[model samples]
Target: MELKILKQDFSIGKLYDVSQADLQNEFCFFAKTDQENSLVCPTEFMPDDMIEREDGWRAFRIQGILDFSLIGILAEISSLLANHKIGIFVISTYNTDYILIKAENFERAVRVLADHGYEIIH
Candidate 1:
């Protein structure tokens, strides 16, 4: 259960699912319509359009060693956010997990995670 947290700033951008045929990398889009809506690796990378909007988004890093051996990591995180009425989009890589919260609930979600004993890097 050892976790290393990193405080990094990331722009909260809008994600839109476009037709696979219409996608272009220059557009900064994330995934195609056929891909799952959940977090995806940058490697299986698809066209993700990063749009600048008036709304804000929250991005955080959960670094350190993770145990894939531990079941329910996603379930635990989802449940934690659910209790606070926050929604999340989770992406994972070989090393760690990245959780994206809507811009509106970003602060509250961070606080809740901190209160629950997860270290807040920032």
Candidate 2:
């Protein structure tokens, strides 16, 4: 599989609630449930109401659209990273899945993926 890195630094956060107006950034991922509202976005655009947050993430997305029928793509990648002791945070959109790694592990994760036959586009 081919992957392209996102340029922005990222953050993962939890919020009590979010209004549509609270979303000021185009490059953000928000998900809500009865129990929690979570956000994954560029650090610069983080919401002021975050109840908890973790910064220093870097992300890369699988290239091209993924069909819903596709299986194990995320598992395969995550497993590989797991073997290397790299943890990942994932976000799935209509088009594709993005994988976020801690900034400290980002370069090593990229190298491992590339070594394992995945194309890496910086």
Candidate 3:
């Protein structure tokens, strides 16, 4: 599988609550469950309602739309990064999965993935 590196830096945060009006762009992920309301969005779009937040993140996505029947794609990539001690946060949409790594580890993570034969596109 191929991976495309995203250009923007990101922020992962926990918000008290959210409404449609809170969302500013398509380049964001928001999940609300019994436990909490979470958001993964570009740094510039980070909202002020955050109860907790972490910045300095960068991201990439598995290239192309992934069929539901396909298995182990995320597991394989996560495992590879785990072995390198690079931590990650993931968000999945209907079409693909986005993996977030800390800014400090982004270059090393890219190099590791490239060395393992996963084509990395800028």
Number of the top-ranking candidate, with TM-score as the measure: 3
Ranking by lDDT: 2, 3, 1
lDDT of each: 0.55, 0.91, 0.90
Best by lDDT: 2
**Which stretches of model 2 miss by more than 4 angstroms?**
none
| Model 3 residue-pair collision total | 0
RMSD of 1: 6.6
- Provide the TM-score for each candidate, comma-separated: 0.59, 0.93, 0.94
- lDDT string, candidate 1, 1-122, tens digits: 32343233233333443343233432222443463422222222333453333233356656665677867877877899999889887657566677867667888887787787877775
Instruction: Quote model 3's TM-score.
Output: 0.94
Over 4 Å off, model 1: 1-55
Summarize candidate 3's per-residue lDDT along 1-122 as a digit string, tens digits. Answer: 79999999999898877763257676889898899988888888887767899999999999999999999998989999999999999999999999999999999999999999999999
Q: How many angstroms is residue 60 displaced in model 2 relative to the true structure, after the best TM-score fit? A: 0.1
Clashing pairs in 3: none
- lDDT string, candidate 2, 18-91, tens digits: 76325768678888888888888898888766689999999999999999999999999999999999999999
Q: Give the CA lDDT, 0 to 100, for residue 86 in model 2.
A: 100
Better-scoring candidate (lDDT), 1 or 3: 3
